[model samples]
Target: MNPAPKSWWGTPRTITETIDNRKISWLELFSDLIYVVIIHTFVENLTEHFNLFGFITFWVLFLFFFNTWTNMVLYFDLHGQNNLRNLFFALLQVVAIAITATFTGEAFAGHYTGFIWAYSFNQLIYMYLYWQTMRNDPLHATTTRPFLIAYVVGEALLIGSIWLPSLPLQQALIIISLLIFVSTVMSEHRNFDREFKQRQIPFELNSAILERYGLFTMIVLGESLAGIIEHMTAEHTHLADYTHFGLALLCIIGTWMIYYTLMDERKIEADRYWPISFFRGIHRFLIACLTLQSFFIGQTLGTGQLVYYRGLSLVTAASLLALLALTRLPRFNVQPLATWPTRWLVLGIIAILILQFAPVFVGLLLMDLILLGIGILNWTKNV
Candidate 1:
């Protein structure tokens, strides 16, 4: 095969030069299957400890996995070989993720060993793939130098922390590991502009990458749907169960309506400017919101009377309100749904706060109404 026609080589090789040619490969989609299982496992754990500390811890654990997956996908888009080498690393990532899944339920409790090793392995795979690209393309390596350093050191600290038997010392090590992980990721984004500027060919976000985020959101919605069906199929489900279940599905649909309507590549591309910060923050927030919404989904599925708690109401409301706020980020101004109805969203959030203290019956009814209102707003073009 020829190297291609006047190829300068660098800005993520694509399969075609046609105007409408950006497409995600089957292998990329196939790699996302493990995430469903990973999300499920993490959610199950979140339910186990619904308190503040547990909730915070759950988010932390989730970010670790979320960050790992996000970068892996981005890396593939930049430098996926599409051969046995790619397959081998992708499979390794799955194995690592599966092993990490085994420990997610109790990552901080007692199974840190498995979690650390698996997590490190995942990071290692990213580093190796990156190193390959770095060796072949020196400029690419230079662009990612900080990330490479932070990732390696972070993995080492994570692994070493597993050995310290002292509870306090181990806890400190764990915190350091998290910092390292976060620092590297931040650096990667911070340095992206430098890379883009230096490159003779400017890098642009394609429909395919944005679509990847949209597809992942769909997977999460599927998880919410599963939660709804689980409750609907329960034995001797009461009217409350049926009602709540129905509302849950409707809420998910409402969310779906708002999200799909706004998540358009054309709109995003039409923006006055595009920054890595915008993409980074928007995508991260959206992904986090879906997981939080799943938390609400599990809560809504409580079939028996007296099942819903104030905490559940509060959390569910926060998820919706947070999502609405995220959609309004200035970076997303191109989309129609990005900024309208802020006042209404505020009211919806207020209703959720009220729901936090109100009875489950009252809460679900109010919640669905808010969702319905947003759904209507999103469905039509009117303000």
Candidate 2:
């Protein structure tokens, strides 16, 4: 009798070849479709209402939306294989993500009761997928067990929180989610280390994973731009008649310039230190910067009012500066600048600050100029 065909759901022995051959498959693209829908929902919700409290609520929901999608993608890269069963499960996840996106507006209105339930259910489905994948390969059974258990427990608590409304259940669930995240990371690292010790993995595999993660960062950045465009156009009857529209456009372009100027493709490839972990953490800050920028742009276009927080537009201007400062952290290698690319960032920040105090239109113009200057500088430096 012949043994059953090997299931195509376990981690592949050759990670490099898996990534290079595009064995990560079309799942990433499928996931991006769901993310784009979520971003559209978020921007629509923001335009309908403009208030600090509402913004904060939406911000929290956005983070959860991002975390859920990112975690699932990371797990799939580590464990998923190309096959009919895996394809079916991946499609299910995409559907679940679409359902979760539908709730963003209500979720932002502090009507998290139903949103949380939907999100928790979505998580449960992904968790089941992970469990099924592990069941097909005993080698992964021990490593994935803790993550599976934690996710189930976390989802249970999260679902329970929906019923309590005012009992700080959201906060509790958030904590549990973090715990589950940590456990999952720990389990993967352990498996990776063991594989390395046994000489079963190669450096190229890890590099490919990091590179793929970087591509996801680009997705988030692109989605943020889409949100900015949608919010600006929807709020104004004749968007082309408003100066704010141009400002929003410039800001979006400037953001892309800043990121691309400093994070050139070659630099991304050359980095050798725990590339996946480092990129994952840094991308969170990048997304935060982009999200806040969208909020500020939406506010300006909708209200034509510029309120200052610590001498900058509460959300728009300040968030941009904050994002710049964040990018300067050692992890991003903006400190102790030995390269010309790094020096341009320092100069760009100073220029941006000076523009912040000018008239709104002038400030935006200056921001664009600075971005152009940085791009030119990066080009000259051979970045």
- Candidate that would win on TM-score: 1
Which pairs clash in the backbone of model 2? none
CA lDDT of each candidate?
Answer: 0.66, 0.58
Please give, for residues 72-125, the per-residue lDDT of candidate 1 as tens digits.
777766666546667777788888877887888777464577788778877888
Predicted model with the maximum lDDT: 1
Candidate 1, TM-score vs. the true structure?
0.84
- lDDT, model 2: 0.58
The local distance difference test score of model 1 is 0.66
Off by over 4 Å in 2: 1-24, 165-244, 266-275, 308-338, 353-355
**Structure candidate 1, residue pairs in collision:** none
